[model samples]
Target chain A: MSFFGPGHGACPGCGLTIATRNVLEALEGKCFVSNSTGCLEIVSSQYERSAWGVPYIHSLFENAAAVAAGIELALKALKRTDEGKVVVFAGDGATADIGIGPLSGMLDRNHDVIYICLDNEAYQNTGNQQSGLTPTGSNTTTMPAGELMPGKTGRKKDMISIAVGHGIPYVATATVAFYADLRRKVKKAAEIEGAKYIQIHTPCVTGWGIDGKQTLESARLAFETALYPIIEYENGELTKVRKIKDRKPVEEYLRIQRRFRHLFKHPKGQEIIRILQKIADDNAAKFNLDV
Target chain B: MKKVVRGFYSIAHSVKLCKPNVIAAYPITPQTEIVENLAKMYSNGELGDCEYVTAESEFGAASILVGASAAGARTFTATCSQGLVLMSEVLLNAAGMRLPIVIVNTNRALSAPLSIWNDHQDSMLLRDGGLIQIHVETNQEAHDMVPLAFKVAENPRVMLPFMVNMDGFKLTHAYEPVDLLDQEIVDSFLPPYEPPVYMTTKNPLTFGSYAPPHCYAEFRVTLQNAMMRALDEIEKAYKDWAEITGRYWGGHAVGEYTDDAELVVVSMGSLTGMVRDVVNEMRREGKKVGLLKLRTFRPFPVKEVRNALKNANKILVFERAVSFGYEGPVGIEVKSAIFGFTPEFYSFAVGLGGRDVPREEIVKIIGDVYEGKVEQGFHFGTIKEFEEVVV
Candidate 1:
């Protein structure tokens, strides 16, 4: 039985909705989900079916982390601390912008909970607003690129690095692209005694301006190109790199989406591609993926 | 016995007496001194058996309090200006989830113009944020409001956040002699928090829900009903405080200063002291003027304001902050408090951003309202007749 529930209302190719179902399925109803206000919140929690068979709480866009901390405490107060898991789920916008305070606080306090940031890379709920997670050379509604240059200027925040920086018990990177790995990591987090962090590479098809069927394809391409490398830390030490396959050139990942079309628009097109290549190379070295 | 302390320290002194189990806070201007002092006390062993959270931001501070309180700890937090805005999200979570978190905000104007001093804008903005709002007139009231805030907030019927505001600079920086309550008495009177359900993994539960529309609408109604029922809780809290301190917070929303007279000047915050003196001076000169100092801003004590104000023919509302497009915020709220009874009021916005409002100006405002010269309203210390804009 699906622990998150039946008839999930996620859009046809919504990676997050699928990822959430996978998460709950892995936890097997021994979890309390704290969701932040975002696209996932509206779709799954709107009118009728909750889509969540397990208990869930939705706090403000900025406070899901804090509420999750409260849930962990609730379990302790109830004297069932060992029997269940506490989970905080949010979009990139909430995790990076509004919910950062509580998230950081949770990590600092080393509260026993798994904070899963579903990085679809843009503020998909507010009409594709550019968020802190938006990769460079991508067109968000806020940072729409045209003939002159590529899209978003900055690179995606190294959230896994940031999480590790907080010295939490576990910090890992996984994706809906790798369901088995995702479930394994989630279960491991639930078993840990303190704060755990996971960055799930869930792509927003509509926001990314890609065909719905390309959801998983793009997710796989992302990891293959080193654009989304999967790494893990234990006891605050960088320990593992999930060596799955060889690297694909970064341009192959960018070519599929119109949002990244600006990167190939002009004389500076090759320059943008070069920058993207450098990003992938950088991730490869930092995460020690080449070994 | 008298002890001199800054408004912030005075608040801290009382908080120490209350003996909170958790002091969760991050620093922000004006109000930071309170939390900083508490942290010092917690570390130096001046306070015992407490967890002092050195948090990341105001939001985190509020959240830490929630977590600590859920773990059956008495908690508190202090913030101001943008910190208040940042805590906006946590504030609602604290109230809606029925967490009795005590929040102290030093009144500071919100950003755009970026003045970091006295203004009611920050506290006024959260007037409808499902928290009990108490504005203080002096260090004594600021010191007193905390215990009452805790009692009112902890009453299960009103398990929401409560803001005890002490105006920045005017109160936060000003030093005054305050008679602190004894710790033994406080411990005996204000019992420690023991929640019915604490946050634990042992027996898990969720707060806040991914509520569908059917459930969402009902929750809002429940919040409304709960807030309405808090009036009784506030009274009971007051009664409890009175039994201990012998202070009468029984005036409902509006505190009186010769309120039986024909002319009443309505005001809030520390400005009440100036208005009180002006009204009494006006009364001595055979002028039928009085003052209504509002201590409670939220749940707007509608009944006492109307009953006490019914005898007045002319009412003058003095607000320390503007509402941008509308009339003075306090003036608008005051008129709404006595709406149907129809007390003719001249609303004024004055002394925003720490600009002083002298007693003479208050007397002039009272005279203007009495003589019906304030056609729209008045703005203290302006080039021309700065009346409250009626939109």
Candidate 2:
């Protein structure tokens, strides 16, 4: 049976929907889902009509990981470990911003659950606000590109490194552009035991100001430009890396999205683009992303 | 079995008898010992089939209980003061989702000048948070209210969260002889929790769904109706426990010397004990004074409170917490409960921030009211001068 049903309120070509479907489809047996208050929860479970075909719950925004820990422990206490694996689906804002404390708590306790961060960069549910995962030089509602400031001035938070720093059993990064790899990472993480974190780069079509048809392309460009790395860690050691072939320039990824349009138009736009390229070069050098 | 133990220990023993599936909490002041004792019991293998998790914060603790309860498990946690304030958001979520979780709130003073002492400020702040709130007057009552709270909260008619409030330093730190209920008797009184709908693969149900303006009010109305239904459920649980244990701490609102009394003093929590003593002393001196102890604060026990105080000519409500711009929370509710029936009503905020509420103070307040020295509005009792410091 399909894990996620139809009639969700997700926008057309929504990368979040694509990534969520891929992750849920990868699960093997019975599963329970704990969702944070975001686009995924709002679109999927609207009152009496729910798009979830599995047992699901949505508590608050910042407590999804803690709630999942509780579900996992309750299952063990009830002697129902064979019932299902507990999973959490949260946004980048919920994972890297308001939810970091509870996320750290869940990891510290090493609860047997998988936490999936559907990273849409910004707070898309709240109308394109700047979140901890919002990349530098990207314009958002909270960090608009004005004459005084170009856009967000800081780099995107390395949430994968933060997860790895917890020394969890499994940590992986994926994007909606690579569906097969995304599913493989989820399936692999599900096989492991202790706390697991997987952050998926799901591009927001509305928030990114990209065409509905260009969602997958935007995610792919993010990976091809080495701006978003596809890497995995096992036992706190870097285990695998998806090598980039025929690397694309950072401008190819920046020029298409309106959030980054200011980066090309401003007088110091090229300077900022050069800085973004230097960031990608640093990521490539750090993760050895070259094929 | 009768044993002299700390109030927190008695509560832990009572919770052990209840057999909760999940217990998650963080340590905070007077509320720490209860969870510490429970953790010790878990280590000793006395708590069976329980997952005891030490949460990072009170917010995480309350959220953990929310998920555990939603997953068809009986769950519990404890917090007070700032911890309660931190858990306020999740507490509302638990109530809104109709999770039958029980929490012990060792009522303490809220921080401004920062004092960790006994007061009703903590639980009073969440008065409208939709949890079924009960205030205990003694250690024994605190011990008994655990299973009683779970019984009412898990009742299918009233699937709401329950908070058992006991004065922080007054009841939590004091040692008292409590007749602990036997495991078999507790088992008979509170059956294993059977949730009507929970997260299960076979059922595949959705919980905590997004509600639009068209139906949000309806969900709130449903919760409010369940709270109203809890009034009867609380009474039934008390009767059932009393049948098995032969100890009843009065249903909702308890009365002492209230019949044909000229003056009635209304209060809650451990402060009622001191007020009861003052009432007894006044009675011996030929003064017709009585005491009305409010047991349940959320539903307010409006009918019972009105019935107990209607015969009295003058009603004095004393509370440890104030509503700041308004008056005491319980006093506000009590006034509204008996608005037309009472002609002389006086509300007093006393013993705030764990200041001593001696019997003399209670007697003095009563004297002032009877002698026409106190007005018909809210008053602050037992105000003392602080040492002047040149900063």
User: Which one is best on TM-score?
Assistant: 2
User: Residue B30 in model 1: shift from native, Å?
Assistant: 2.2
Chain B TM, cand. 1:
0.93
**Can you tell me which runs of candidate 2 are displaced by over 4 Å?**
B386-391
Q: How high is the lDDT of residue B190 in model 1?
A: 79
Query: All candidates: CA RMSD in angstroms?
Result: 4.5, 1.5
Candidate 1 chain B lowest-lDDT run of ten: B198-207
Per-residue CA lDDT of candidate 1, range B129-158, in tens? 888888888998888788888877787767
| Model 2, residue A82: C-alpha shift (Å) | 1.1
Judging by lDDT against the true structure, name the best candidate: 2
- Tell me how far the alpha carbon of residue B284 in candidate 2 is from the true structure, in angstroms, after superposition: 1.0
Tens-digit lDDT track of model 1 for A18-108:
7888888788777777788898877766545566666666657887787667656545544456656878889999998767777888898
* lDDT of candidates 1 onward, in order: 0.79, 0.91
Q: How does candidate 2 score on lDDT?
A: 0.91
Model 2 per-residue lDDT tens digits across residues B267-377: 898988888888888889988888998999987788998899889888899979999999888888988898789459898998888998888888899888866798898
Best by DockQ: 2
